[model samples]
Target chain A: NETAKAELGRATWKLMHTMTLRYPENPTQDHRDALESYFYLTSRLYPCGECAAEFQQLLKKFPPQTSSRRAASLWLCSVHNEVNARLKKPAFDCANLDATYDCGC
Target chain B: NETAKAELGRATWKLMHTMTLRYPENPTQDHRDALESYFYLTSRLYPCGECAAEFQQLLKKFPPQTSSRRAASLWLCSVHNEVNARLKKPAFDCANLDATYDCGC
Candidate 1:
């Protein structure tokens, strides 16, 4: 069902996004099962502004993150945004307290 | 030699903690070069209340985070606090704009 896809997308996205900042390089395939399950949801879904924005933010916040991690975060941020957008809810903010994000750039 | 360990500890601590929130499983072998390089520093260093506090906060904030990630966040937070405390700076806040953290809890 479409609803199932939507729910699965949301769940995986959340997991991926949350893992990214913590395991950036690669989650050592720890989440392969979850990733495999969500393949359909990810493929069915299209990219939107929120996902795009999160991709941009992830790039800004974790420049050294692995491709898998980036993709996961981007995917989650998009779906997270999609559902929230429907409800007209506000965007999520994880603003760092530091002036600089400590990118070591 | 001791000072070098401290510097290494600080750098790796930052890397590990950031990754923990993003990739809560394992950071793969990509950062192994750095992690192995800093093993001596991490082992040589002792935990203080600051590190202990950060560890507690990490547990609170990233309930789904892995032990390794939690340890890294805790170490970074501890050292981060120690440095910030020395400078008399404010706490770092990555507050979400939403009332709920959306942990889906």
Candidate 2:
């Protein structure tokens, strides 16, 4: 179960990071809504109930920063580092976030 | 670029399918809304613009069926088969939907 959970987490993170990285630099209100809504919906429908609850709590604390691509990606990176800390995993260097996930879009 | 797109595609599908499979058998209105919004948001925010446009078209043709777990899963499977056909890939066996994606949740 732990293995499956970890694998799912990795996949989910990949998708989220890639999507955020690809977000429009100067998005319209609609684009911002879509991005914010996506995160909330993911929290609700995540396959792992425990992870879903944790995400919901995180959302309450951090909310989603969708003003621009830089803000959104950095916000996610910071949140991911929070998760890493809780899991006793090494923190990702947020400075290299842009270099880390290249969707080649 | 193609490699990144393919990798992103696989991760997105894995997350989507597992989320649908784990959807409640008798979901509340909020849950239904969350599921529906997730798909639409995905269409708008997908990392691959071409793929996102294609998904938006498919969504227009066949909107997300979030009434129940069975409906949601079957709808996704059918749509995935549509993509497989487009890519000249073999169709997945939808009959084994539950058996195939064991998230070990």
Candidate 3:
């Protein structure tokens, strides 16, 4: 169960980071709203209740950054590091994020 | 890139399947709406353009089944098999669904 939870986290993070990386550089208000709402909805519906609660608290503490692709991705990386810190996991180097999540789409 | 894409797909499927598995047995309308909207948003915001398009088409062909947890999971499995068929990947036995996604939450 712990393994499955961890795997779910990894997958959710991958999808989110990739999403921000692909977010339009010059987004319309609609795009920004979609991104923000997506995060809230995700936190609300995430399968893991504890993680979802943690994520909701994270959102309250550090609301989603939706200004641009770089802003959003870095924001997510930092938030992920927050979760990692809580889990006593090693931090990811944020500078290397661009190189890390190429979707090849 | 393809590797990243494939990994993303696997992760997404895992999260989604687990989500349906944990869904309320007698969900309220709000829960069903959230699930349906989540899929739409996922298709709309999926990082991969081609896959997103295909997913959109799939949603049109076979809309999300939100009547019950079992209904949703099986519908998703069938849809996943459809994708696997197109990719020439081996089909997963839907009967083994419960055994596959145990998210020790």
Candidate 4:
């Protein structure tokens, strides 16, 4: 179960980080809305109830930043570091986020 | 790029299917709303622009089914099949969905 949970977390984080990295540099309001709503809804519909609740709390503390691709990606990177801290994982360097994820798109 | 896109697709699908399978058997209206909005927002924010547009079109035609866990999972399976067909991939057997994905949560 722990393995599965960990795998799911990694997969979800991969998708989220890639999405933000690919987000438009100068997004329209609709684009921003979509990204913001996606995260909130993800917190609600995530498979693990406990994890979902924790994410909801995190969102409340640090709402999603959707101003632009860089903002969104960095915001997500910071948030991910918070989760990493809770899990006793090493902090990910937020500075090299662009080099970190490649969606191959 | 194609490899990254395919991997992202696989991860996203795994999370989505797992989440649906774990959905409340008798969900509240709020739960239904969350699931529905998640799909819509996902289509809008998907990293692959072409894939996102295709999904948005599919949503217009099929919409999301959020009445219950069974309904939601089956609906997603069917939608996924639609995608598989377009991509010339083998159709997934939807009969054993509960056995197919395990989040270990």
Worst 10 residues of 4 chain B by lDDT: B96-105
Higher-TM-score candidate among 1 and 4?
4
Runs with alpha carbons beyond 4 Å of true place in candidate 4: none
Query: A38 in model 1: Cα distance from truth in Å?
Result: 7.0
By lDDT, the better pick of 1 and 3 is: 3
Model 4 lDDT, residue A101, Cα: 82
TM-score versus the correct structure, for each prediction: 0.24, 0.98, 0.95, 0.96
Badly placed stretches (over 4 Å) of model 2 are none
Per-model RMSD to reference: 15.2, 0.8, 1.2, 1.1
lDDT of 4 by residue, B1-105 (tens): 798899899999989999999999999999899899999888888889899999999999999999999999999999999999999999999998988787878
Measured by lDDT, the strongest candidate is: 2
Write model 3 residue lDDT over A1-105, tens digit each, in one string.
787788899989988998999988988898888888888889988999999999999999999999989899999999999999999999999999878888888
Candidate 1: deviation at residue A90, Å? 2.6
Ranking by TM-score: 2, 4, 3, 1
* Candidate 3 lDDT by residue in tens digits, B1-105: 688889889878888898888888888999999888888888888899999999999999999999899999999999999999999999999999989887878
- Per-residue CA lDDT of model 2 for A13-85, tens digit only, reads 9999999899989999999998999999899899999888989999999999999999999999999998999
Instruction: Candidate 4: count the clashes.
Output: 1
DockQ of model 4, rounded to 2 decimals: 0.83
Q: Score the docking of each candidate (DockQ).
A: 0.02, 0.86, 0.77, 0.83
List, residue by residue over A19-55, the lDDT tens digit for candidate 4. 9999999999988988999999899889988899989
TM-score of chain B of each: 0.34, 0.97, 0.97, 0.98
